[model samples]
Target: MAEIETLQELYVDELKDLWSANDQMAKALKKILGQATNGKLKDMLQASQDGIAKHTDVLKALIEGQDEKLKKEHCKGMEGLVAEALKHTVEEAPKTGPVLDAAIIAQYQRMTHYGITGFGTVAAFAKALKLDDDATKLEAAVADMHKGDDLMSELAESAVNVEAVKG
Candidate 1:
């Protein structure tokens, strides 16, 4: 028979997985920013980098608060996503304006979706464990990032650079 998993076990495992994912995304985004030629794209990357740092801090506190040691399990999901983003970036490099912008938007959205999923999962786990304060804080942070992701999508769809790519 399969062993049943406790809530604490689930939370700790998921948190470690998420932390690793965030670190991977952070590195990938920084690399993209370094290669980005568009001022607006660079700004977005910088904002995202800051957000990733904040998320890392929160994850660390949550793990430590549970008396768990800070550690990361390899997050294969995030590794795959980051690899794909790097491939796309390399495939479209130096193709500035709309083409480059479209690629950036696509890659950014993928990373954002990954973050949203991770944060939401953590928040739900916190709630299930009756960790009310932690749940609230995690949910708030997730909500803010969700909004940012939506805004980035909107900007990509309507921005001149994206439009230029389609022209």
Candidate 2:
């Protein structure tokens, strides 16, 4: 990683980091999605994976727009989150039922919140640098992440959590 001496450098670096994060999260989701029991949860996870891919493309475009190399800095932050997500959802996961589904939702939300924060921060940075177009694109990515988070929350509350409580 290059030393970021200016805000623009930091912003581009973050974009690269986010690109890496999205790739990590997407790979993790592909594994986790198969473990999900709830139909809605499965659908949402699949959709979220698609969204992550789309966001990665956007990040790549943003990096190129900044005349930066189309490369990703490994995001240690997301590396940790992905580790925990896999830990709970796959390694130590409960049987394929509501309990496991509930755990999946929790892990998924943790990852999603990380994305929300990272993208929101980049959007702010873009705005601060008067990069209105970049800011707009990043903010849209943030919104899409939030939408997935909301769907997971709804699935948990409306069904998964309730079913888990019965066990």
Candidate achieving the largest lDDT: 2
Q: Lowest lDDT 10-mer window, candidate 1?
A: 90-99
List residue ranges in candidate 2 displaced over 4 A: none
Note the residue pairs that clash in candidate 2. Answer: none
For all candidates, the clash counts are 1, 0
Q: Write the per-residue lDDT of candidate 1 for residues 1-167, one digit (tens) a residue.
A: 12328877888788888889989999998787766655777787899888888988888888899998888878999999999888887655646556666677788889889888888998998999999988987898798788778777777777845566665
TM-score, every prediction: 0.90, 0.98
lDDT tens string, model 2, 24-121?
99999999998998898999999998999999999999999999889999999999999999999999999759999999999989989999999999
Output the number of the TM-score-best candidate. Answer: 2
Q: lDDT of candidate 2?
A: 0.93
